[model samples]
Target chain A: MEIIISILLLSGSFFIFLSALGIIRFKDLYSRMHSTTKASSFGLLLLLVGVSLFFNELNVYVKTILVVVFIYLTAPLAAHAIAKSYREKDKE
Target chain B: MAINNIVLLLSFSFLIVAFILAFVRLLLGQGIYNRIAAMDLIASIVIGFVLVYAVFIQMGLYIDVAVIISLVAFLGTVAVSIYLKNNTNKNDGDNH
Candidate 1:
């Protein structure tokens, strides 16, 4: 179980590391947003699942799950909002 | 347990490296939008760091704090977006 948890966490960290890479490598706003949103959300999902699974207590698991859900809901919306602003700014 | 510690250390190192890269990108961004995107990435990476630290230390408080940080970070991004929108529109109107 510990091994499984560690692997999950490490893989998640790798995804986030890639997300950071994307932020640096991508030239424009849209591509950067695409990389940041997808990679980070997936990374966060994995990390939350790994941590929650390791904890036996019910509430901790529940809280982590809620946090995951929160990230899922907010990430895309925030991305959209920022992208829209970028577009609007561009039109000017 | 020792292996787990080593794994955690490696993960932390990766995150720190990523964070530093993102910070450099933020500094070098050509425009305000790029800067904002880099800033957003920075916040997410920091949240990732906090979370791994929390789990490494087995602290419940850090979990809650992570949640709060995520929410606040989201709010900040939205606020910046709105500010950018208004700023652009105002500039356009002034030019016209």
Candidate 2:
């Protein structure tokens, strides 16, 4: 159990680390947005899963799942909004 | 137990590095969009930090805080995104 949680935490942080690195390394707005939006979402997902595993109570499990789902539903929309605005502003 | 401590330590270090990188982008980004993205990234990484802290201390209340942070961050993203769209549209008339 501990091993599984540890693995999740390590891997999630790694994902976030890579995501941040990409944000710095990428040269464009779209590329930076891509890296931050996708990688961080996944990183959050893994972290939530690991956390819920440790807690494992009904309420905590539900709350964790809710947060993960909310992030998934909103993150892409936020990225899309930014990208669309970028296009709108830059094209003119 | 020792393994858990090691894992948590590794996670904290990684998250700190992530924060630093994102902060660099936030500071040096050429465009406002890049800065916005960096801010968003920081929020997500902080959420990761909250999660790790929760597990490290074996506390359930901390998870609730994590949930609230995520919710607030999402709202912020939406608000900023809407503002960006409106601002862009307003500027489009004069841009070209």
Model 2: what is its DockQ? 0.74
Candidate 2 local lDDT, B14-75, one digit each (tens): 99999999999989989888888888899898889988888888888898788888888878
Per-residue lDDT over A7-87 for candidate 1, one digit per residue giving the tens place of the 0 to 100 score: 988998999999999888887789999999999889888888877776657887888888888899999999998899988
Candidate 2 lDDT over residue span A1-92, tens digit each: 88888898899999999999999898889888889888989988888888888888899899988998889998998898778877878776
Given candidate 2, what's the lDDT at residue B31? 81
The list of candidate 1 runs beyond 4 A from truth reads B1-3
Candidate with top lDDT is 2
Over the true interface, candidate 2 deviates by an RMSD, in Å, of 1.6
Q: Is the docking of candidate 1 incorrect, acceptable, medium or high quality?
A: medium
Q: For model 2, what is the error of residue B4's alpha carbon versus the real structure, in angstroms, after optimal superposition?
A: 2.0
TM-score of each: 0.95, 0.93
Q: Which candidate has the top score in TM-score?
A: 1
Enumerate the chain B TM-scores of all models.
0.91, 0.86
